[model samples]
Target: MTFPEKVDYVIVGAGIHGLSTAWHFAVKLKARGKCDGSKIVVIDKDSIAAGASGIACGVVRNNYYQPAMRELMTLCVDVWESDAKNLHYHNVGYMQISPKCMEEDVAEIFAQQ
Candidate 1:
């Protein structure tokens, strides 16, 4: 088989995790002016997002019951909101209903961190 002449990143699996990682790598490479000549090859036994991501309910929640978890979720929210402009992400709004326990847990986590 003919292979690419050069590659900057070789990603295996095209599920949500792999694709997301590749997206970030592309962003970083572009920001550093390395994307022009860089090659990012993602290989998977199946098509992109065809595994768990395809079957996933597409539900995003902050129910991890940890402050750090909530903080991380918040970071995800920020990125998702702004990703449309910077990364060409086209998606609807994010929605999450926090239970009282999760809220308390997140509060404590934030306080501790």
Candidate 2:
């Protein structure tokens, strides 16, 4: 396909991050009645899912040590849950076994949420 000479947004890769960004951008544009294919462009030297993101095993979890990270991961989990059926995501949940020393820290983090 021939790409447009001018694009409002140029995404460099077709990995998970780039694809997610493009999808969200398209959704936003559609909501504003401005979703035209020419507005955003995604270019990758290789085919989609041919990079690091694809090679790594896909594991979704929310057991983060930092509060901010936990919050961000929660948001990501929500997004995945929102489209579970279409995305083929299984909400099997996650578990983390902390050592005796870290148990208190883990509990504190959970309490903050």
- lDDT (10s digit) by residue, model 1, range 2-110: 6687776899999988988888888888889888424888888878887888898754555565667778977876776775577655566444457886776656554
lDDT against true structure, model 1: 0.72
Q: Model 2 clash pairs?
A: none
Error of 1 at 47 (Å): 1.2
TM-score of each: 0.61, 0.73
Q: 1-113 in candidate 2: lDDT tens per residue?
A: 89788888899999989998998888888888997545888899988988998897677766677888888988888988899999888978657687899998878877776
What is the C-alpha local distance difference test score of each model? 0.72, 0.83
Q: Which pairs of residues clash in candidate 1, taking residues 3 or more apart in a chain or in different chains?
A: none
Q: Quote the RMSD, in angstroms, for model 2.
A: 2.6
